[model samples]
Target: MFNPKLHAWLERYFYQPGYFEIVISTLLLPFSLIYYCLVWVKFKLAKPVKFSIPIISVGNLILGGSGKTPLTKAIFNEFSNKYKIFIILRGYKRESKGMQIVALNGVIKCDVATSGDEAMEYAISLKNANVIVSNDRKIAIDKAISLGANLVILDDGFGKADIYKLNILLHPAKEPRLNFTIPSGVYRYPKSFYNLADITLKSSDIIKENSIIKPTDKMVLVSGIANPSRLSFIYDRCVGYEHFGDHHKFSKFECESILKKYNADSLLVTQKDYVKIKDFGLKLSILELKTTILPNLIDKIDMFIKSYQISDRIYSNSQKGDLC
Candidate 1:
């Protein structure tokens, strides 16, 4: 059981810069050296698979929540019916051995605890769309194609040497894009990794302009996410906030704590945080961010896809149905 305080301290050091940080980073060089070597070997042996379908990856260098799921949802919304959209995840935190296909009809079901929290969130959010989780992304893409999917969206996959073409990198808003290694900071790789990006972007501006919640209402901001600050920025003037871990499971005691902690007319939440406490038995007025992208996002993404190599099914969005 990791305490919230330790998580907070790690998150603080994860972003802050100091002499100790420099020294630790220096010590961590050997690990990076090993990672780089593996990358090199993987690069040498890895054969870029050319799929009949166009595989577009939306990812980040950070270790956890950088809003990639929201962006993926945005992309899917943009092209779901317009094109046959299939989403693939690496299944980061999930627990199964073999690959699995998640099908949620009226009930919400997922493999998040094993597949990873982010992947689970994506599975739930895009319930209407086809979501698959597999370790080998290329294998997942192949499976999607077999299932009649024309376009596959690689959720949170980048620098993945195995998948080629149409790489879009996600950067956090507050964090400066630099060469900080993992465990020390959110970055999974170095700043040089940005070189692989076709479109480099910050999540802050995107969230401010597009999140669904309105600023006029008095609401309690409840968060159990990796980057609470980003969500805080969106709900700055909210009456109160109850913070939790990245994937915290709220006990009955904690739910009671929330009820005792704040006095507000309603509650506001990020999609990530919303899922955790939704069934908490507290009938507070709840609000959620409508996942979407900035204006002209569709046009830009479409034009970029046209330049890539994909099959005819890629453009066949003529299906007379919504995301289902």
Candidate 2:
């Protein structure tokens, strides 16, 4: 179902559009308008269900590569000591279906195939929190509550208008030249939707530190993530680069072949990609990128949690009185 060429074309069309891309985008304007209307209706008709537990949603307006996972990890690290935290996601490209518990109370319960790359990354990286992947977010939240989670962090949850929570929207360092939706461009939601978020953060708001251990002077960069161009910071140092579709499962043979093709001593990859191939017994150098939330953002999150704990009105789908 994943076409690498199509993916690459869309990326260029969305972010670095020239005259041809602009004309194509213009032709797709009607579809974008229709998509916008449908989303607007969905939000208007949404009856978001809220629970007694505090929920923090980190999401973005763009389609992908907005640093939601990193931000979620940062938030988990900040609050995991205080509350029984649960991180929930849709498990974008997992092989399994239904609600899957990737990790529970610091113990990993599933493998990469079952948990997907991002969820598995969370399970392996954050030990104190639970990680769950499910298409039905309401069911996932209920499961987390039953498992004694006092706080929940939803990854890429902005579109779930049916869930009432403190919304934090992330913006990429550089937005697309054309802000069209879906086929026309990469924006999942209109830029105006940013105003609805409880806190909207730019890429500059967070600090990133990149480090590589056992580094090679020139290595081949092999990555499977959205917006690979964002790695421009490390481009000058790499001898070669090979990009795959976001969350593409890499095989031992493929990795070895890539290394040979570039004639490089090692393959450089992101942390998210590392979890999948760690057991492959291949030569790898990880591009360890750590993200930290600013103090002001942390203070805002604390305030939201405090206010949520004391609030009496529980958001619900029904017009009846609030539950609990």
Candidate 3:
């Protein structure tokens, strides 16, 4: 339901300020205050849920396309072998309303319509983990634990004070890191709000510089994501783009139409967008670009996981005698 044009407009207001934008931003400033108040009320009223399992949250302040999806997938790849992981999605725009476990032990049992785009991507790619979709974080984790998930990775759960966990907030590589309320800007919270996170970083800190063509190459960058412009790294070229709305479903015709219009040498796509493409049967020679976390970041994350795991064990072991 998010309009791509409005998304572009917001990006300019938040990160790319000019004379006209400044005047517009000033007009929207009053609305931003109201937006901020609503956010505070929502979180304040939200019930905080706690789980014994370690939670690693990868989220963004600038809304979707902050590259959190790739980051979440990367972190899951790193820790899946050691932990029975569950990635929780809100199942945005799905017909269903409750939690559904789409994958378990590397087997996918649900389709994209039920699990939403991001959840389906995880269910499809990360065979070793479970993907559960639910708005209620507590219920999702409860189901996760019941299904043998020892760790829960929250998708888009930054400042979701409902659950006490390790939160990593993502900023785009080139974004000036604007923190305004929705309607006025992409950020739901203020700039100072990132301090609430365990780690505040750019996607560059963890993203792998995956192989791609130079900026001079004539490639067509095609995407249907919340933040299509965030793919700027791949756009370091004479790249023509075909962007769609957030969670936009691409038809087979649309896919072919784009390729025909651009007539570029190579095609580029996001992992999330690729799933939809496959479903639509638009199989072009596409370069799949995914960002990955850095090695040092892995170590830092591992340490946090270990610290939580160790304390959990100590508490579990200590409580044994008390139960007896």
Candidate 4:
């Protein structure tokens, strides 16, 4: 199902467009237009269901990763002390079905295969929050509520207009040259849709602290994530690099063969990739990238939480017939 060459081609076609790329994008415009109309209709017909607990959604307009997981972790860190936080997402490319609890109160409950890489990442990173994965987000939210979650954070949840949430959209640092929807380009929605978000942020809004301790001079880099070129800083230092489709599960043989083929002493991988290969008993240097939300953005999030709490209290009182 996952073709590495096709993925690479799509990435280039979407982001770095030359003459041929532009012509291909032009040919695909009709399909993109149809995709756009479907999305518009979905939004218009959506009757978003409001939940009792406050929900914060971190999402992006692009097809691939836009640092949503790190942003979600940052938010969880900020509010975990005050509320019983639960992180919910549609476990992309997992083997399991129905709702699965990846972690509970910092303890991992399931393996990567059941939880997926992103959910497993949350499970391992956030010590105080619960992590759940399900195809149906509403079902996941209900499960979180039952587990006594005072607040919910939804990963990649912007598309779900059926659920009421404080929408936080991340704008990628590198905008696509073509800027068309699927089949033509990477954008799931147009740039104009940014106005609908409660709070919109850019890659610059978050701070990244890279931790590479005693790094090898010319190791081989093996990564399975969207936009591998985003790590060009590290890639620049590597002797060679092998990129797989996003969330590609690597076998021990594949890893060993890569290292042997490159004739490299050390291997480099991202934190997300590390979780999967950690049990293989292979020596690896992880690129631990710690991200934190800017102070102004934290303040904005606080304000939204306060407003939501106030409105929720008023609605509760009205339901109880306490206000006449």
lDDT of 2 by residue, 1-324 (tens): 456688778777988998998999999999999999998899889999987788899999987788888899999999888899999999998999999999998899989999999999999888665999999999999999999998999999999999999999998878888877876888889888999899999978999888985678768898999878778788778889988878989999999999899898888999899999899888788898789999999999999888887663433333345443
Q: What is the TM-score of each predicted model, taking all chains together?
A: 0.78, 0.93, 0.85, 0.94
Write down the TM-score for model 3: 0.85
**Candidate 4 residues 112-227, lDDT tens each?**
99999889888876776599999999999999999999899999999999999999999887888876888788889876789889999987888988886447776889999988
After superposition, the stretches of candidate 4 with alpha carbons farther than 4 Å from their true spots are 1-5, 213-218, 322-324
- The runs of at least 3 residues in candidate 3 whose Cα sits more than 4 Å from the true structure, single-residue gaps closed, are 1-8, 41-47, 177-179, 212-220, 232-240, 260-267, 317-324
lDDT of each: 0.66, 0.88, 0.75, 0.88
Instruction: Report the number of the highest-TM-score candidate.
Output: 4
Q: Which prediction has the highest lDDT against the true structure?
A: 2
Candidate 3 lDDT tens digits, 1-324: 556678777677767877888777778889999989887787668675657888888887765567777788888888888888899979787667777887887788787778887888888777676889998878888888888888889998876777878989887665553456765666766666777788877745765556442322566888777657766765666358777787887777777777678876545766676666776654434445566777788888888889988998998998997999
lDDT (Cα, tens digit) per residue for candidate 1, span 180-220? 56643456666667886777777543653344444346667
Worst 10 residues of 3 by lDDT: 207-216
How much is the lDDT of residue 300 in candidate 4? Answer: 87
Model 4 RMSD to the real structure?
1.8
Task: Spell out the clash pairs found in candidate 3.
Answer: 106-127, 208-292, 215-236, 215-237
Better of 1 and 4 by TM-score: 4
